[model samples]
Target: MSHAGDGAEVVLRLDRISKSFGALKANDAVSLTLRRGEVVALLGENGAGKTTLMNILFGHYLADDGGVEVFGQPLPPGNPRAALAAGVGMVHQHFTLAGNLTVLENIRLGTEGLWSRGAADARAKVERLSRDFGLAVHPDAKVGRLTVGERQRVEILKALYRDARILILDEPTAVLTPQESEALFATLRKATALGLSMIFISHKLHEVMAIADRCVVLRHGRVVGEVDTHATDKGALAALMVGGELSLPRAEVRVPGAVLMRLDGVSTPNRGAGPGLKAVTLELKAGQITGLAGVSGNGQAALAEIVGGLALPVSGSIMLKGEVVTGWSPGAALAKGVARIPEDRHHQGSIADFDLTENAVLEGYRSRFSRRGWMNWRAARAFAEGIIKDYDVRCPGPETRIRLLSGGNMQKLILGRVLSAGPEVILANQPVRGLDVGAIAYVQSQLIAARDRGAAVLLISEDLDEIMGLSDVIHVMSQGRLSPAFARGTMTAAELGLWMAGQKFEAPDAA
Candidate 1:
């Protein structure tokens, strides 16, 4: 029953697949094939049915019509076990890890259930696997202590532990630092060389080009095109994903004025044993975007924490507007013209249960929306309405719960709150984490406008497209050290990716 068209070629195939929800056609006669040892890029925007299709394959949802074939064998509808038994494994965009548990416990949680017979064996194997794949995770480390990149490695290990031959990675690099991402790609390449097949889902076109052998573009819930990565460029792939021209314009050049924020000899305790920044020094100038571009785990979080007033630097001076503000409280940072949009919006940016109006004024509720040491409903409602209209935030009304909005809308609301106060400095980390093409454009436009209006921007994002689009100076971090390469104007994505993967480059001054 192997899907070897002429010997050992095709491994999986979907024929004329279609799925629907009420009147909406989620998948329109889509067809694709995964050849042996191939890495296929599934490209699409949000709500474009990429997840829907994957869900169908993973048995979360059933296709109304058509068939799924693995090794040329037909798969019954809505059977996850069958898929797993057939050698399919999936790593979701969101981690399904229990935060309180250790890495080994989380990995063995569901698979072993109430029994714990192979704990030692699994740990040893995971360690070996980590070393083999360059994943480099501590199996004994608590999941909560693990950075985003480490957690992702655990997820990948979990999939592999199940003996899966075909892996599905959903936006795998979305949270990875450039070095971690490169390490991951190296693992995937090794896996492929060992006869494993993979389907990689991502919004980043350059990642698709770099890691994938073939690319499949999805738009409006349909397969638009599939082509070899070697034959196409980002421009063409983006055109297919957006169904039109998707040109990301560069921010206008501006003369950066006074030092907005300065960090000298910044160092923090190793959040974990793996890597923590060492003697970090950086500066953000008023009216410019200083992009911190690193592979995921190399102290971006620690840096954000220190600058945003979440964590104090062990030994460093943080200057804001020419005044040293090291060890300042969040309130003090805000008072000194520093506003932060935390990396994880759900946990740090907004209160999910809070209404739109309430979330809109979360950071500034004391003075602007509250009065007489009491809640001011009128001002809050009016302010929320203004943000909705001005920022084009799509929501029911001011009373709508923030969690009810889409990821893009929530990001818009969070950004609206920060920018509304007109802070002189903004620390935006992964600002557009889960946005669509249109939403990304809107948010980028907002940041660009903010820069033009003289607000210094600290743009930290895993998406290189975003960093490249908005950064006045791109600072790359690798293994907890800042690279001296600062790219400007038109630079190739490959070069940036290389720098992000820890390649040594000449100093920015030399460039």
Candidate 2:
């Protein structure tokens, strides 16, 4: 199973695979192999062709040259159903389940024929699958009611129910907690013991080292290197993938000014739908970044929305710069020198169909780019061009559709636009969630720069590493309650993980 022994079975083999999109060669003459009962980790930067290569193997894309052989037989090009029949299954980052449908109904949609099994039989199989693996989800529960972690388990169950031997998981743990991730890897190990081969795609180095047998590094449309996970360090893997030295942002010294914002016993009732803030009290001072760390589906979004003036708490007051600003609209928040970068970039950060110019003018059109009740297209275009140049956004031109840009580029544009306002208070939510290492470094540096410029920043993220790296004060949010804020370097990750799991921790005593 390791390195494809002479007698070992090869489940997947790609030889001299190449694909081109217009002038850019997404994948170039790449070769790979997946043996039975082995886990391979795919390492690469953004736009490095890892997804393209995986897509080619899964029949989502037709390669210009070379071939994909599954189980020692040639796989048809651009046919996902055929790939599934050949025992190849792909779990995308975003779950494709319908919210209104039950788990069993969603799983049965395209996987099985009506003649194959009735509802009762399907439920029985789902129960067995759930028990067999560590994946537990109520088959009859509506998908909308399930948590993010539960939905992920359902996704894996769907693939397993299809009788897939070879599975490809893309950023599987991107939204899971540390405990949930441990459970998932434990389940994956059990599956591997039963002769399942897998390819895991992720940017988190420590997880890959723990879960994968070996690592394959890709750089700019080509295979650069491969090594055993145990033998190579994360630094080596990052160097190989990024193709250069990695420089991280250095923390700067700053004297934090007076409190820019204070939340006093803020409480929001959710009407029994989900979690909401409860008697939360907090403060954000100028020239410091306050990081809120939590699992994906916790109250991070609610906290961010309330602070950004999108959601108003039922009780308590929000004081900004010594003025009560509770129940203020988003425009009022912006006018009062508050900037917000939402958690979900596509739906909350920017309009998808709009061009870069239009997106750039979203917050500033009324004041900066509008005159006499008319939007000044020339001024807006200039502002967008400035962002494109300053942020290093890679696209066709300034007028290009924002949706057409890659995730990282779109993030850069968003940061550029928000920072251009020079707001005194910032609420950044999951700012660098899906970006690559280079882009992450850039975004972190930008946030730090803003902090050094005397702005009060509220950073809400699921990444403990990010929160630990860039916070002056760190707090964990769980089940709509804010934990006591701990000064930087005062708490360990293990302690924070416990707090994120809803454990109560007493604040450190101040002498």
Candidate 3:
């Protein structure tokens, strides 16, 4: 049966969907409809059941109650094969791609497993699909060599290769630069025009306003509101998502102190994980935010590690507070008052298997929690509890494992642990990457507060808006090289984008 209500086809529908984990009801009688050739934005705060509902739709989790319908047919529960057979596909926030495999191989992996009738036909069809969808990529290129945007395109290609007609994209633009995000939106519109419906899950209110046709707001595991994007504003949508009015904190003006940290011709080895610096020179001063803007993987991670003492520079010297601290270890840097809020919170910022109490003392256990080689579990718990209260980290309790907390909460805990150390320099790498609007405001405010307290802050981020809004001086990194620092409000986002693509922006003085 085809549902052509008002002459538009309903491609997907969920009626009174419910799911629970232990005592927490993640989804409570939720309902939704995704129509053909339309893009719907699913809005919510962290842990508001958006992902839980999508997991149910994709057969990652079995719904305790209610039913899922795809293309006007009820889908069997707890079976991904059935969901895929029904033309449902999902692109997760954390990509599940085989890095060593080629793009085409990854795309056709599960769908055409074991045997193939014609290799030429498969290649030709892949090319045709790439051409039709504006998803340009080298079919034989290694997945690991591709950029974040390229990887996302490959994921979409995989879903399409599996004959998926309805797509669910989870935080699709979270890892993309401004230019890449715009290109993604354009590609999505092209797909929509080809009669494919999409569910775009995102916490970015601006993106929701820009790309969505209809807005569905989720709060506390329930459907709180639904409205046309044209009719609703970001403020109203934000209010509905968090169940309250959320205001962005205004940036404060501050007079920068003397030079505190300097990276004089710093260079690192190209170790295959991130872009290594090529004679990159930079400076950070007290009471100021020195912003480093780039497409992620373009040396931002390397720069962060070099500064945070996780990785030693192969060349050049690092000067901290007028003292030479080259080749210093992480513990050495911590001892010298350097606090790092790492980019990857799961692997670098927090220990997943450990409880909040343990993760809280990961860096400070030697100095704060341990004496005479014996660990003080009670003192660590106390510290963790304080962080939970002060940072407003929403978790079950301090005894809960770090992996069980939401991304935003984990980030909050990381910030709390590092900031509580009373550091002189702050290395905030992608500090608000996956946080909601409210959490973003909190993180930004905290960074500003740190700067106000005379910390030399090195802020590395892919978000151009954030760099422009927060930094006193901005430098663009491209191809492992650093451009000359521009004063606040000196360069536009477009100019930054060009630089991010490894293109030089020749100023009038140089011209």
The runs of at least 3 residues in candidate 2 whose Cα sits more than 4 Å from the true structure, single-residue gaps closed, are: 1-7, 98-109, 113-128, 136-146, 250-255, 374-378, 503-511
Each candidate structure's TM-score, on Cα atoms with residue i matched to residue i, is 0.78, 0.90, 0.93
Clashing residue pairs in candidate 1 (N, C-alpha, C atoms within 3 angstroms):
3-71, 176-296, 177-295, 177-296, 178-295
Highest TM-score against the true fold, candidate: 3
- For each candidate, what is the lDDT? 0.82, 0.87, 0.87
- Write down the worst ten-residue block by lDDT for model 2: 502-511
Q: Considering lDDT, which of the candidate structures 1 and 3 is the better prediction for this target?
A: 3
Root-mean-square deviation of candidate 2 = 3.2
lDDT measured at residue 134 in model 2 versus the true structure, 0 to 100: 77
TM-score of 3: 0.93
How well does candidate 1 match the true structure in TM-score terms?
0.78
Ranking by TM-score: 3, 2, 1
Q: Compared with the true structure, what per-residue lDDT tens digits does model 1 show for residues 1-511?
A: 1112234577789888899988778899989899888888988877777888998998889898888999888987799998988889999888899888888888787778625685778888778777766677888899987767788988988888777888999988887756667777888887887788889998777778888888898887899899888899998988887788777657987788888888888888886554666788898888899998866677788888888887787787888767777458888888777898889889899898999998988888886766789998898899999999998888779999998777888898888889988999999998888776667877888889989999899999878778877899888776667765374665566777766666554445423
Q: lDDT value for candidate 1?
A: 0.82
Per model, state how many residue pairs clash: 5, 0, 0
Worst 10 contiguous positions by lDDT, candidate 3:
1-10
